[model samples]
Target: MNVLIVGAGIGGLSLALMLHKRGIQCELYESARELRPLGVGINLLPHAAVELNELGMMPALAAEGVETSALHYYNMHGQKIWEEPRGLAAGYPVAQLSIHRGVLQMKLAEAVIERLGAGQLHTGMTFDSLEQDEQGITAFFIERGSGQRVSRRADVLIAADGIHSAVRRHFHGEADQLRYSGRMLWRAVTEGEPYLDGRTMFMAGHQDQKFVCYPISEPLRRQGRSLINWIAELRVPQAELPTTDWNREVPAETFARHFDDWRWNWIDIPAIIQGAKAIYEFPLVDKDPLPRWSVGRATLLGDAAHPMYPIGSNGAAQAILDARCLADRLQEAGAGAGHTALELALREYEAERLPATAGIVLRNRLNGPEQVMQIAHERAPGGFEHIHDVIPENELNAISIRYKRIAGFDPAMLARRTTP
Candidate 1:
């Protein structure tokens, strides 16, 4: 079967690799003419790390990213709310990696180019539309530089395009579907001394105002320093969403004041804000889960399928999982040159993943595992003498475990799934 994948981001590249692993032929087309190591850092949960490990890319990933050791949550006063060991430290048999998104994308793209052959992956191709009959799906793309149109036919078309996906817009229609939270995020990286174990990820404050910080560079960590990736999120009063571009740079002064008093004994939040060269502003928004993600010979994956709030650090993780799941289903269905088999396989993939990711979308709306912070804030607005006094240990543990299960990374569940 010839599979056509749109967008060379994490999901699309991962799906291509996964398909190749199963000996299935696939081609990748990305809108960006060049894939740069852009964007700040992101955390790969243990489950996602395991998937990449299965693909035999963990050594390369570990070289580029730090192996995250733990996760912690704190209230506005910098008082601890909850803490848990993560990745291998948490006994999942894999390390949760914290790597820059652009670097990871480039790594995945490099793999695609190498395994799929030098000329297999194409950039400068922007998806326009697609049409499928009983035989196969034909997709349309416009060249990025020239006014030329390129067309390709495949047994199935998988749209792994991101949040602003054109293929998705084609199906849902361009009525503006992004649901903006009142909050906006300013994300950037800072180089400084490492905090807490040199490999910890931490978030302070509640949903309205929050500061997240973590080291993301293995090379820096080895040098006894750190490259910290941080986000300063604030609730914006505007009803309309600000520019949702992930690369839109803005002044730190726009949202730095909210975190002026956010410094604590261990880490200084204000200095971290002032340290960044540029802060990219993006609205904390998500689309309402679609009624369906697959239609006939075409289907959606990754952000195209489920764009959720990045609360639990599951965006890339979920996309990797989707790629694996879809590839598995197609392999099971014996997807061939026949479009009918591919369609059935896509529907099966959708039936399982659509509902799963939709649940995460809604759960993240409620702050997911970070709900511990919300509960603590609501229960004790002034500040807590003791977090346990405000929110019980059981409640905190329960919230974390529940989110892990919902996000498909529950320890027992992963063990069962990974068991040969």
Candidate 2:
């Protein structure tokens, strides 16, 4: 069976690698003429790490990114709300990695090119549309270099093309629209001294206003410094959507002033904001879960299927999980499986992932595990003598565990899935 993958982002690249490992024929088409290391940091939860580890990516990940030690939540006053061990520190089989998003994509692309050969990965191709029949799916692309239309026929077409996926637009059209979260996020990286434990990820404030900071560079950490990746999120008054481009740069003054008083004993928020050479402004937005991610010989994956808030660091992680699940289902469908068998496999993949991710999408809207911070803020707007006084220990622990289970990274659940 031949698989045509749209977009060379994290999900598409990962699916290609997994298919190759299963000895399946797959080709990756990327809209970008070149795959450059771009974007800021992203966290890889244990479940996502487990999938990448299967592909022998842990070493590269560890070398390039920080193995996160703990996750902490704080109130606007910088008072602690909740803290918990994370990654290997949390006793999972693998460590949660915090790495640069662009670097991670390039690493996955490198693996795709090496394992599947350069010929299998095509750049300068933008997905135009697709048509599927009983025999196979034919996808059309505009070759960006020459502005000519090109078509590729394959047994199945997987769209991992992200939130603005053309394939998703083709199917859902105007019905599929991004729901703005009324929050704008300024994302960037800053070089500075390490914070708590040198490998901690922390978030301050509630859903309306929040500051998230985590070191994302292993090289800098080893040198006794840090490369902090942070997001200063603020609630925008406008209910209408703002520009959603990932690379839109803006001055720190746009949102940094809101976090002016975020400095605490451990870290200084203003300095970190000032340190960034470039800050990207993006509104926090997500698409409502689709009723179906697959139709006949075509299916959607990653952001193309379920674009959720990045609240639990599950954006890329969920995408990776989707690739693993889809690849496993396709492999089980058998290599020479006809279009009928392949379509069933796609539906099977959809049945399992669609609802699971949709739950996360809705849950994230409620702030997911970060609900602890929200609860604390709501109960104690001034500050707290003790976090438990505002929010009980049991409540905090329950929120964390529940979110972990929902995100598919519950330690016990993972052990069960991988224990054989």
Candidate 3:
């Protein structure tokens, strides 16, 4: 079956590579005139890393990104509340990757072109709408280059077009409006001395006011330099949603003042903020989970299917998982399988992933695994002499494991999953 994929972001490109590996014919339509490396840092949990490893991408990821060793949660005072070994250090088969978001996208895009060939991946094509019938699917796009509308026919259309997906807008419409969480985030990268073994990810403070820091560049780390990616988040006073653009640049002064006193012995939050050359502002927003992500031969993936708060670093990981699941289901359906079989494959993928991600969406609103940080803040707003004095050890471990299972990355779950 010939498949049409919308968007060339992480999810779409991953799906393209997965489909090609299954010997399926697919083409990608991306809105950008050309794909450019963009955005800040993101983490690839072990479950997601397993998928990438199967794609033979672990080496490339290791070369460009740091393998995150541990995750630390701290209160506003910078006292560690909880710490857990992550990725292979945590005993998973693979390592969790902390990499630049744009670099990962570019790597995935390059793989798509190499495996699927250049002509299969088309840029400057904005998805406008689509219509599905018993025969197949027809998708219309506004060709950005020529200002002309064009249509393509395929047996399936998978929309991995991200949070602002036009296909999602067409299907879900009014029901898919973004729900702002009253939190704003300032995301940027800075070069500096590495903190905490130079391969750790740490988040300090509660949900309202927090500072997250992690090293994202392995090469820089090896050179005794560090490319630290950080995010300073705050509970903004605005009730309405701010601009949702990911590339919206703003002065660090917008949120830096709140974290002014966040200096600790090991890491200096203020200096990290000041060191950033550019910081982008994004409101913490997510859409309510849809009842379903498939309509006939058309379906959604990644942020297009479920946009959640970035509480657990599960955004890109979940998208990679979606690509794997959808590719598997589609492969099982077989290329010659008629439209009815194709539709069933899409539905099967939805049935498995829809509720799974929906749970994460609602759970993230309540802080997901990050709830421990919020709990510590609630119980000890004045700070505590010991974290266990404020919260039990079992509670912290339970919170972490529960979120891992909810996000489908529990060690047991991953151990049971063999490479596809």
Candidate 4:
């Protein structure tokens, strides 16, 4: 089957690799004129790490990212709420990764080009539209800047475009799909002394007001230096969404005042905020889960399929999972299984993953595993003397486990599955 994948982000590139592994011929059409290392850090939970390991890219990933050792959550007063060993430390065979999202994308794109060769992955081609017939599918594209029209035919078209997916918008365009949470985020990386364990990921505060920090660079970690990726989020009173892009730079003075009193004994929050060279502001928004992802020979993947809030560290992880499942079902259908076989495979992939991710989308709105912080704040508006007094041990454990299962990264369940 000649599969056409749209967008060459993490999801699109990973889908290319997975399909190639399944012995299927596929091509990727990316809108960007050039694939540059863009965006900031993101976490790769254990289950998603296993998928990349199977693709034989773990060594490359480990080189660019930190092998996260633990995850810690604290309240506004710097009091510990819940802590857990993560990645291999948590007993999963593979290690969880905290890498720059852009670096990971470039790594995956390079792997795709290496295995599939040059022309298979095309850049400068923007997806304009597509038409599916009883025989196969034909997709139209235009050069990004020059507007040179191009058309290509394939057995299926898979949309792996990011949150603002043109293909998804073309199909599911409605009044107000991108639901704003009234919270805005300012994200940037600061080169500073590593706080806590250099490999630890931590978050302080609740949904509305939160500060998340983690080290991303491995070489810097080895040198006793840290490229600390931090996001300072606040509940903006804007009923309407801000005109923001992931790369739009902003002055820290905009949101730094709200976190002026955030410094504690172990970590100095103000210094980290001021140290960042540039900060990009983005809204904390997500679309309501779609009722379906498959239509004829075309289907959605990654953010295009389900753009959930970045709670519980499941954004890229879920996309990797979706790509793997789609590849598996497509491989099962066989190369010469024909168009009917392709449609069935798409539906099967949807049936399994659509509902699963939809649940996560809704759950993320409720704060997912991070709900513990919300619960803590609701119980004790003032700082807690003891976290147990505010929330029980069983309740804390239950909340963590429930989100793990919902996000499909419960280490106990993952232990049952074979790793690459």
Q: Is candidate 3 or candidate 4 better by lDDT?
A: 3
- Badly placed stretches (over 4 Å) of model 4 are 244-246
Badly placed stretches (over 4 Å) of model 1 are 243-246, 335-337
lDDT of each: 0.90, 0.92, 0.93, 0.91
Q: What lDDT tens digits, residue by residue, belong to model 3 across residues 56-169?
A: 989998999999999999999988899999998998999999999999999998898888899999999999988888889999999887999999999999999999999999
Using lDDT as the measure, the top candidate is 3
User: For candidate 1, what is the TM-score?
Assistant: 0.98
lDDT of 1 by residue, 64-159 (tens): 899988999999998999999988888897889999998898898889888999677988999998987888889999998996998999888999
lDDT of 4 by residue, 78-157 (tens): 88999999998888989999999989999999999899998999999988888889889899999878888989999989
| True lDDT of residue 390, candidate 1 | 91
**TM-score, candidate number 2:** 0.98
User: Backbone clashes in each candidate structure, one number apiece?
Assistant: 0, 0, 0, 0
Greater-lDDT candidate between 1 and 3: 3
Q: How close to the true structure is residue 169 of candidate 2, measured as C-alpha lDDT? A: 94
Worst 10 residues of 4 by lDDT: 238-247
- Regions more than 4 Å wrong, model 3: 243-246
